[model samples]
Target: MDFSFLPKYWAYFNYGVMVTIMISVCVVFFGTIIGILVALAKRSNIKILEWLVSLYVWIFRGTPMVVQIMIAFTWMQFSGLPTISFGVLDIDLTRVVPGIIIISLNSGAYISEIVRAGIEAVPKGQMEAAYSLGIKPINTMRYVILPQAIKNILPALGNEFITIIKDSSLLQTIGVMELWNGAQSVATATYIPVEPLLFAAFYYLMVTSAMSGLLKLLEGRMSNGGKA
Candidate 1:
């Protein structure tokens, strides 16, 4: 097929790439925070807290992300967003709120398990040793356990970052002009479906491949007797 369509919409493609990257960064940042909280909650001594976190993880991880996005979009459209009467500083939360919330909640569910596993991988003696020195649990986790857990989980987090890039395309369904959405728009406008899609696929390949290489390098660094 002719990829002649690429040049015509190069600007649009660039915008799509930026939007994709922007949304993915937001998702990863918020998702990681939510995941850490969920992971800690799951291990909490309170039965109610653990049960609530478990339910959240179950619902988010069990359902399809597309469905969640669709539902979130529908809900936002009906409810609209909060309005501020500030002069030139009013925030429009409607457009982005649904997408960010849905994607982060979904990603957080998966990341929670990854984080839980990483933390668990550390030996129990580490905590015992910290406690033996009269260390507070929070300080013990922050200074000792979490540092090791982060090292172990860095590769998985990188993988999740790559996954978020691809998955952000789902936001296109809600009329977000992300990479796939740009391609779909191009295909419809140009009447050349395959090539525009292929062009978008090329960008996705480049992004994911680059992230994979970076993850491998990080893994090597972390594995070399913790040198890096």
Candidate 2:
């Protein structure tokens, strides 16, 4: 009922917001790279590669993300990371590194499917036309297929970014000090659990809403051939 604690604890939420954004950005970036590779491998027509990529997607997407984080955290404990300072940001690699890796891998599995669908949506004739022009398969994909496919799947990729933003809360369990973790710290300090959590929810809503607006604007520009 009382938000008088806001002034006293705003810094915790601010730091948490920053950490959440950083983790989400890293996850989306690395996940997109992994997904592109996996998608290409799945479509590579080599049975071995397809099988391996398929298995990876199955294991990662089939399992819950929290469990993956736990497993990765435990694994890292044996050979964990040392503290890394970055001016205002001090990273505890033992938690932050493993949290990012596991979440990115999880996002990668889902993204692989999105990318594969995008790639498939491209007309076969385009690929064949490139090949007919003596273009290497790699060059064909680079110059022709991927560009169209990325546009086709831009909405889905944006949704994935939003999903990662929410999922970053799970990193709190590993002591990564993301948004949810920051809320928990404030809850402990303020002795008012529900208020802090409600405040955190407000931040999540604001972020996702802003992201959705940006994506709509981007989609419109791309749809309009980059016109204003």
Candidate 3:
């Protein structure tokens, strides 16, 4: 129960925090794009495209993310399928790549629904008006529907980003050395579990709380602007 170990191990904790942030940023960046695409696919007029997107969302959402990461990493390593290759060179995808992919895919499943809900939240009148203006469906979505929908969904998207920040901890199970892994490493090395674990918890709390505050501020501004 040495309280003094916190300051001594702050550097390791900081490094871990940085890695966690990096992973979360990467996950959100790619995941948002994937989610938007999936959302659009789910709403496609083509039945096959809608069905495929539905299946993807159901499978990823139904499974545990840790299990998904394990499977992805193992498959990449053992499948002998080159993740990327040029004419003469091949690159093997490792734990980190699959780890990020799994997390991003999982995040996309949830974000897709958020996006779908956002799109649906727009009034039918908006769609009809766009159509009356001779706007193609794609342009209606691009210029009118999605912009309005995004405004409605910004708060939810922020919440999902915060969720991603926390869920990034699960990557530690695969030896990705994110925040939780760093805390675990410190605990194993120093034999003082509580302090390091608490430090990690504190870091998570700080991040999530800051995100919540920012989202709230953004939501308020949007609300005020809408009123204006």
| Model 1 ranges with Cα > 4 A deviation | 78-93, 224-228
27-104 in candidate 1: lDDT tens per residue?
999999999999999988999999999999999999999999989888888676774433323333565568889999
- lDDT for model 1, please: 0.87
Query: Which predicted model would earn the best lDDT?
Result: 2
Write down the lDDT of every candidate, Cα atoms only: 0.87, 0.91, 0.86
Off by over 4 Å in 3: 78-93
- For all candidates, the clash counts are 0, 0, 0
**What's the lDDT for residue 194 in model 1?**
91
Question: Which candidate, 2 or 3, would have the higher TM-score against the true structure?
Answer: 2
Which candidate, 1 or 3, would have the higher TM-score against the true structure?
1
Give the alpha carbon lDDT tens digit for every residue of 34-117 in model 2. Answer: 999999999888999999999999999999999999999999977857988765577888888888999899999999999999
Q: Candidate 3 residues 1-228, lDDT tens each?
A: 566777777777777777778778889999999999999998889999999989999999999998999898888766454445433323234656787899999999999999999999999999999999999999999999998898888988998899999998887877767789888998998888788898889899998998899889988988888889
- The TM-score of predicted model 3 comes to 0.90
> Pick by TM-score: which candidate is best?
2
The TM-score between candidate 2 and the true structure equals 0.96
Superposed by TM-score, candidate 3 places the C-alpha of residue 138 at a distance from the truth, in angstroms, of 0.6
